[model samples]
Target: MGATQKMTIFKLCILAGAALVGTMSVAAQAMTPAQTMLGDAPSVPKNIVIMIGDGMGPAYTSAYRYYKDNPDTQEIEQTVFDRLLVGTSSTYPARVSGYVTDSAAAATALATGVKSYNGAISVDINKQTIPTIMEKAKALGLATGVAVTSQINHATPAAFLSHNESRSNYDALAKSYLTTDTDVMLGGGKKYFPVSLIEKFQAKGYQYLSDFNQLDSIKQGKVIGLFANVQLPWAIDDNDKNKLSKMTAKALELLSQHDKGFVLLIEGSLIDWAGHNNDIVTAMGEMEEFANAIEVVEQYIRNNDNTLMLVTADHNTGGLSIGANGEYSWNTSIIRGVQASPDFIANDALIHDDWLARVSLNLGFEPNEDEASQLARARMQGKEVMTTSIKHLIDSRSNTGWTTGGHTGVDVQVFATGPAASLFAGYQDNTDIANKLISLLPKAKSKSQSNK
Candidate 1:
């Protein structure tokens, strides 16, 4: 075996040992009759929790672990994913499209089990409306909820609950939520809906809330929590609040109370944003928050064997690489010096000639004489060029490298447990994720419902 293979095996063994120490017996005992062995058949779980880390790839997960480790020995520390992963999946869009996929196309495929055009929400490749897993779950009398760190109408979460020809139709998508039976919707973007529509939502029995502190008042019923006008602030900037984990835990609590069970979608939406910024510290913070939320789901799964949990990503962003500067070693600790993302620092704060001073203060370093000259020229060129220059300097100083400022056509990892998770175990198309979950769902009255 290659050296890398040996390392992976070692890590797996360590994970197995840790699981044994944790609660192997609790997991086994909690398995319901449906989960019992039926020859080669698997269980159809009553509850399904889908967690999408918006721009995660192997590099992102690996870098997350590096940051999690003790930095002294570089020994691994097992996260929830280490125990649950079934396999990996190719993130390509439909055969009708290109190899690369944005979150909209990928999330559409994941929600409806249909190959779709980029930006196609829950609509099919031909722009026809298709029933999503959320809709199917609702039709079967199962509770449905969506909790994400992104705006509720964003590509990933919107695909589950709304149908639109273009994901950019945020206002339309927000209005369209009135047409679905999705019980709970949380996260940002209240601005997309006008007061009339918001009142209509409240009139329709959907509780509309935006204050993050008011989440506890929701016990059992329909709710629409739009916490931010846009996407929620980065986890680093908002470190005092574990909003993602709180949202996930709250969704699980609300959805699991139904007698017929539930299906909920949760997202760590801004990992992709961090990737787009090529901000490693911000990405790490997002991943850490995401993992904390995943812990809540796993804890729930330990007692609720009827639930299936799938953790995956739509696509990779930033084409992030850990080893920059031709170094054999990785210093995840270098990120401690970073205070904010270039996007925030450049646009959110006061801009002045002394801006580089704040950059130096946050990044722990200042540009050399020649690099300073380049920044001046870029600023003189325009805001766009200046933004690009700032992000480049930030990444460069930290030994991080990004191939693109946008998404990549990489195959993201899939982690699963409960029910037919084994189906996700090989290289499969993005649509297969939705297909496999649809197949594992509680038997629908009309058999054709599983197909779309």
Candidate 2:
């Protein structure tokens, strides 16, 4: 068949899949009362927290279950995911952008309930601004903010707070955040906000913080904290492993003070970075950190019945698999022994005289003669090659498999809790998540009503 014919066939397959999904959704809704959609019910939430585990696919969660499992126990222990998983979400962007989605398009759909071309942030396919859930919450007199491990202006958070034709317009996104009326914004990307711009934010009474330690000192009011130059340090390498969790706690504390409640977007953003690098150690560490954040939110929801929390991913990255190369088992023990990220290990070894010692020490296991030779050969090639080699070796040891460094056109898992969470159950598209969230938000006041 010609290329055009193949493309037509692929699109047909996608349409057929979508039809099946719709049918399954109907079947799910008919299954039980707990799965019923509560449209405009009295149980509307006063607060909403949407947590995005960027690039986290089903496989990642499944892998995490085993990674956190206790070997001494006969049955595998269930994590927070097993307890609250509601359904799966298809993450395809607009038809024009094809099946697989980038973070920007996925975030746009999640933020605005509108699909857009990849790289567009909160803008429709026609390059016009679409209202985001955060904007809507602000309009309704509720507080709104975003907390992520990535730079606050990165694709996911940027989509929630700003409108831009391109996600790469980092400077523009940062500037836009100045007037977003967002109550709290925490993450990295101090470089994007120059002294003058930060002063403007200060002039507007936003308490700007550059140090992570300062997060706790401010007990009230609008706050913006930028903790790193770009993204924060990896979970495995950081002094505070619960950094995302801490941010989530602070966001909840600050946003909840608003009388009208709040809308907070918390993203485990570095999970995508680890996936893109095919670094299993870092991926697992990021997963653990993300889970910590989830626990924080889950507890908050248990305490606050008026809050709704939804957790989903933008798309699956690295096509992660549990076993590889004809292996029948994955060795979580090996992964647990990894003390640092592959890139960190590789860089440390390059400057050391005893490269094997450094490598073995970081890996927490001595390499065999053959493995040592492989490491030496990679070290000879240079830092970048050594990093890849280290990851490959770790993957081989742990039997972790990755099909690609880029994202795949796969359905990601959705988890929800609190009032109206059941409405998120069953098969749905990414935009459906945004649409449902938008539906639950309180109506914005008219200008004349505000004047009155």
Candidate 3:
């Protein structure tokens, strides 16, 4: 009947990036699990499913909702987040040194309940390893797994699974997986792990799946899926079927076998990538993919009464702003008509004289002679320049505005449903997210205290 009784449920967190102002802020703390507010509350959660939308921001979701709601406009036809919206969380890292936080720090804060330095992964600015929620879940005998659209060793997921002073330690980060007996792992980034180490994993009884078809036949036990050599393609070009829904479905099916339940982190990693390009088509496509994954997770929660699902973003990306050129109203019809992302167009733009013409074909608007000239000039300059030009061209065509291709300091929304989901309401810092989740788990002495 009391609040503590509700804390015993499992948690599924899907980090969708939409804007909300953060109401509270806090300094970084050691990974000390908060003592139970209600002493009678259970410490163990049956399952925790967290899916982080890497660079999703408020404008991203706003545009998605508007476009979806206005058949002539939205990126997603519908989303579970519409009904489950909770609150927002501040994304700044541990210190006043900077306001905007990078993926590593934001994710580390979410994973360890600590505000780490900009590039730190599950480690504080002091360079000490901070124990993560996933680690705690695993230590308590709960199954742990991660399914992401990024390389398994990418910063966001790495913050949950590895600890390093530098997030760029791809080799070190990837190897850390061998040391941790995580139940299931899936994503791109085969290049990060060596052939020898991957072989060692198989020898250790880890089932390695290299494709979705291979993933389809998975029956049980620990799994490591490496679907690409690096980051997977945008959701629009996900012709190979490495869909987020499939990844989440497979992860849920496998992780649910644990008697103690599971803690699985599924990341819509490409959302950030799309944001970096300011590719609205790609961003919306990725949102749809993430939304589909949420739909699947929602079904899981429906069948399983004890599951708590949380969705939030690490940081907003691309400084995306809808209704560009001071328009009183924006048109969703443009977004609705696009068949391919600018990233795809940029790639095809190369090796063709009429690439802008091709872009018009895919985007439903043709560039003027001056715009086409700029694209040709950019193509002559290099890939980076050409890509920028392509995105700018899309911006010109669709009137989608962006301030930056990098991450922003804006607050992001956190949506939740299930028992104890109300604990996540209000303006909290990113660390509060991990801290709240930790409170639901059995109180353990702080890792810092352990050394003492």
Output the number of the lDDT-best candidate: 2
Residues 46-112 of candidate 1: C-alpha lDDT, one tens digit per residue: 7899999999987998888777887567468866666666578788887676888889999988998
- Compared with the true structure, what per-residue lDDT tens digits does model 2 show for residues 1-452? 99999999999999999999899877764542223323333367889999999999999999999999999999999998887788999999999999999999999999999999999999999999999999888887899989999999999999999999999999999999988999999999999999999999999999999999999898999999999999999999999999999999999999989998899999999999999999999999999999999999887876777888899999999999999999799999999999999989999999999889989999989989998899999999999999999999999899999999999999999998777787898799999999999999988768898899
Q: Please provide, for model 3 over 137-170, each residue's C-alpha lDDT reduced to its tens digit, 9 standing for 90 to 100.
A: 8887788899898899999989999899998999
lDDT of each: 0.81, 0.92, 0.80
Ranking by lDDT: 2, 1, 3
Q: By TM-score, rank the candidates, best first.
A: 2, 3, 1
Model 1 misplaced stretches (Cα beyond 4 Å): 1-42, 347-360, 364-390, 445-452
TM-score, candidate number 2: 0.91
